[model samples]
Target: MNLADIPLRPGGAELLPVRGVRARQAFDNRDWVAVEIPVALEFNGIAHAVMLATPTDLADFALGFALSEGILLARGELYGIEEEYGPEGITLKLEVASAAFARLKERRRSMAGRTGCGLCGTESLAHVSRALPALPPGPSLSKSAVARGMRELASLQVLQKVTGAVHAAAWCTAEGEALLVREDVGRHNALDKLVGALAKSTLAASTGFIAVTSRASFEMVQKTVAAGVPLLAAVSASTSMATAVAQETGLTLAGFVRGDDLVIYTHPGRLNGQPATA
Candidate 1:
C-alpha cells in the first residue's frame, strides 16, 4: 500500500516536501523519512553517550543500552528513567543503583555524539570485548523455523514499509512465529530495543531466536549473547569478528537468510533439522 493510504501510528514516519521526476515528468512530492535525532543517555545526571536514533522507545533504548553495554548487570539496578526534550534533542536521565553508577564512572566510557554502531569512544581495546554471560540451553530452531521467522519478520516491519529506511529486530519462537519486533534507523539500535522489550515483557525469550534485517556484527553478537538468546539470524553476511565471537560464545550465527537459502556461519548444530526450500 502507498503512504497515502497508511494511517500514521504513534511515533510514525515524517513527510518531507521534495521534488520528484519520473518518466520525464516533474512534480511535487512529499517523501516519507524515518525520524532520526540525537538522543543523549545520562546516568545519575552524569552525561554518558549521545547516539542518533529514532525518538520512539527512548525508555527501552536506554535500558537496552545499559544492559547490552554491561553498564548495569540487572534491570533492578536502574531505579528510574526520565526524559527531558528540547531543541537540541532528547536526554534520558537514568537513576541507577549506586554500585552500577560507580562502576560506570570507573570505566569512563563516553560516547557523546556517536552516530552508527561500533565501539566508538571506547577508552581502550581491552574494552572492545566485554565479558559475555553463559547462555542457557536454548531451544534449537529448525531450518524451516528460521525461514518462517524471516518471512514473518519481513512482513511485520510496519515502520520500515512506511519509511523504507529502518532496520528491524524480531524475536521469534522456535516454530518461527515473530512474537516481538522493534525498528530503528540503526541496526544495533533496533536489536537493543528488542532486547529491552523482551526484558520488560513476561515472554520466555530463551525459547526463541533473534532475526535482524541487517548484517551480523560483533556488537550484535555480543548483544545477543547478553540477551541470553541462542541464535542470531541476519539478512546479510556475518563479519569475521562476529563469526569468531559467536564461535567463542556458543551463539549460533546465520547470515544471508533468504527463505530457506542461508549460510550458517558458526554452531550449525543450532539449526535442528535438515534444510529445504521454503
Candidate 2:
C-alpha cells in the first residue's frame, strides 16, 4: 500500500502548518505529527479498555490487543470486528467466542479502565506478570544479519520518517530481511500492530525475530514473549526489569543496535559471530 496516498486522519498521522523560530529567525513550516486519540475497545458489547493510540490499522490493533492482553486464546476466537466513529473517539467492537467473552468479563470485573501501559489494570502482583511458556528453540541469527536488520529498520519506518515522533516494530527473517513493519506513537501499540499483522498472515513466526526502534522496556519484552518471538533487538537500551523478564522467559534481548554493534542482554548464543565494534 502507498502510504503517501492515504488520508491523514485515517492514516494515523497529520501534517499541520506552523510557525518556526530558529536562531532569531522566524519562518513558516508544516510538520508531520503523530495523531493520538482515545480508542475504546469492546468485547461482546461490553466495554473493555480505552487506549491512547494512533488510529490507523485499527483492525490489526484490535486483534493484537486481544492476543497480547490474553483476552482471546487464538485468532479463531475473534469472530468479527466492527468499527464505530463518534464525536468522542473511535470504538472497536469485537465479537469473540463465548468462552473468551466470559474470561474477559471475569478479568474486567477485577479491574477497570486499563491504560496502554500494558500493566496498568493489573489488580495484583501476580497479575502484573503473566506466566509465559519457554520460547521454542529457533534458528540462530548471525551478527551480520542483526546489523542489516538494524540498518533496514530505519528506512522501513515510513510514519516515523514523516512525524519524527513515532516508534516502529518490524518482523525480520533470520537472514535480516524485514517482512512487515508497523508504526505508532506508542511503542507498545506498534508492537501490538506488528503482532496482529503477523497473526493474520500465514507466515511462520518461529523463523524470525522482531526489531523495534525504541528502548526495550518490560512491556516490550512481555509482548514479544507473549507472541512467542524468541529474539528482540532494540535501537536503544533495555531497562533492568526488562532484562530480568527476558532472562526469566528465555527471550534473547539485544539493545543499542547501531550500525554493527549491539549488546545482547540474554541468550547470547542465539547471535552467531564475533561481536561487531564501533
Candidate 3:
C-alpha cells in the first residue's frame, strides 16, 4: 500500500473540500478530529493488548513496542509479525520463540488489562520513572548538523505535512546528513519506528544523533538511551524530568531546535563547539 494512501488521521471524518471561486482550486478547511482504531496485539496465543493507532507502520509499531516494553531483547528474538485485518480491526499477531516469551513473562509482572495506554501497568510514580541504562559516549555533532537534521525531519514527515496531525523522528550524522526518518501520530511511536528502522539497517546508531519533532518527554529520552544513541535533538521544549533522565543516562538532549536556535538541556559538550554559558 502506498504510504501516502494511508489516512493521515485515521478514523477521522473524510476531508471534502469546498469548491472555491477559482475553477481549478481544491482545498479543505482545517479541523481537529480524534483518531481511534482497534489494534489488537496478540503474543503467542494470549491476547496482550489492543490499541488505537494511526495504522501506517504497524510492523514497526509492533517491533518497537516489543523492544520498548522489554518484551523482546533484540529483533532476532521476534520470529515474525502478522497483521490480521478484519471487520473488527487490525490484530497484530507477534510470534516469538519460547526463550523470548519466558523472558517477557519475567520482565512484565502484571496482566491487569491496561491495554491501550502506552505506559501500561505502572502503579506508582516510581514505576512511572523507571531507570534506564546509561548511554555510551558517542561523537559530538556539529551545530550545522543539528540544524539540518531538524529541517530534514520536517520534510520527511509526509503524514504530518498532509494532516498536520503527526510527529516525526529522524537520525542523522554529525555532518548535516540525515539517515533514517519515521513518522507517527504519537511522538514515542515515531521514535520507536526510527529505532526499529535503525536496527533493521544494521547501522551503528552510536555514530549519529537522534532528532525528534516533538517535546522531549522522559520516555523519549529513555527510548533514545535504549537505542544506544547518545544525542537527542527535539523541535520543541523538554520537561524537567526529561532533562534529568538525559543527564543520568549520559545522553545529550537539545530542545527548541527550530531554524537557527536551540536550547541545550544537558551534556552541552556534545555540541561541536565549546559549551555556551546561558
Candidate 4:
C-alpha cells in the first residue's frame, strides 16, 4: 500500500494564537504546535498499551507498534485495524492472528503513554530487551548517498517544519531516494510508523537504510533490526546501549550525520568511503 494513500486524521497540528512579549514590547501572533493525544492500542479486544502521539498515520502507528513491541510476528499476523474516537481520546482496535494474541498474553506489559519513554510497561528488567536476529547484509551506502539522504529527510519532515515539535523517520534507497517517511511527536513512534509502512509495502528492506531526525536509542535500533533493515543513521548521537545492541545484532549504526560527515559507531564496512585500517 502506498503510505501516501493511507487515510490519516487531520489533528496532527494546531495553530494557537498567543501574545508574545519581549523587552516591554508585546505582539499577538499564532504558533503551530504538534498535537498529542492518548492513543490506546487494543489487540483482540484486549487493551495492551497506550501512547501519546500526533494522532496521524495511526494505522501505521498501530502496525509499527505491534512489530516493534513484538506483539505480532509479521504483517500477516495482523488481520485488521479499526479506529474509534471518544471525548477522552482515540482507540485503535487491532485484530490479530490467534497465535500472535497468545504470545501477547504470555508476555503482558502495559505501556504508560508518554512521548519520550519507550520501555514504560516492563514488569521486569529481563523484558526490557528482546532477542533480535542478525540483520542480513544490506547494500553499501556511499558518503554522497548518506549526505543526500540526510538532506532529503530534513526536507521531507513537513510536520517538523511546521510545528518544530515532531520527529521524523525516513527510508531511503542506497542512491538517496526517500521511499517512505513518517513523523510523530515521539522519535520511537516515528520510526515505528516508518517500519510499519515499509512492512506493508513491497519495498525490499535490504536495499536501503533508515534515517531519523532524533537521537538514536536502544529501542530505535531494536525496531530497525526487527524490520530487517541493516543500517540505521541518526542526525544526533546514539546511546551507549543502542551502539552495543547494533554491534551485537550486526546492524550498521551511524550517528551525527550531517553534510557529508557521519560517525560510524558499528559495522563501518557498510559505508563506502571509510578509510581502511592496518
TM-score each candidate: 0.92, 0.90, 0.81, 0.93
Prediction 1 global C-alpha lDDT: 0.84
Model 1: per-residue Cα lDDT over 1-278, one tens digit each: 34234333348478878797899999998988887777889999899888888877878888988989888888889999999877666788999999999989978777754436667788888878877865655466788899999999999999999999999999999899999999999888888899888888888877889999999999999999998888899999999999988888788899999979999988876685422111
Q: Rate the local accuracy (lDDT) of all candidates.
A: 0.84, 0.82, 0.74, 0.87
Whole-model lDDT, model 3? 0.74
Candidate 3 error regions (>4 Å): 1-36, 109-121, 124-126, 273-278
| Candidate 4, run of 10 with poorest lDDT | 1-10
Model 3: colliding residue pairs: none
Per-residue CA lDDT of candidate 3, range 142-204, in tens? Answer: 778899998988887776766777778898877767888887666777777788788778678
Q: How many clashes (backbone N, Cα, C below 3 Å) per candidate?
A: 0, 0, 0, 0
Residues 107-170, model 2: lDDT tens digits: 6633333224566666667666667777766567787787788788888888888888888899
Worst 10 residues of 2 by lDDT: 109-118
Q: What are the per-residue Cα lDDT tens digits for candidate 4 across 1-278?
A: 23233234566887667798989999899988788877899999999888888888899999999998788989999999999987667899999999999999988996786899888878889898999887766566786787788899999989899998999999999888888999999998999899999999999987888999988899999999899887888999999999999999888889999998899898888786432221
In model 4, the runs with Cα more than 4 Å from the true position are 1-9, 22-25, 273-278
What local lDDT does model 1 show for residue 232?
Answer: 93
Can you give the lDDT of residue 209 in candidate 2? 85
Q: Residue 264 error for model 1, in Å?
A: 0.4
Error of 1 at 140 (Å): 2.0
Name the candidate, 2 or 3, with the larger TM-score value: 2
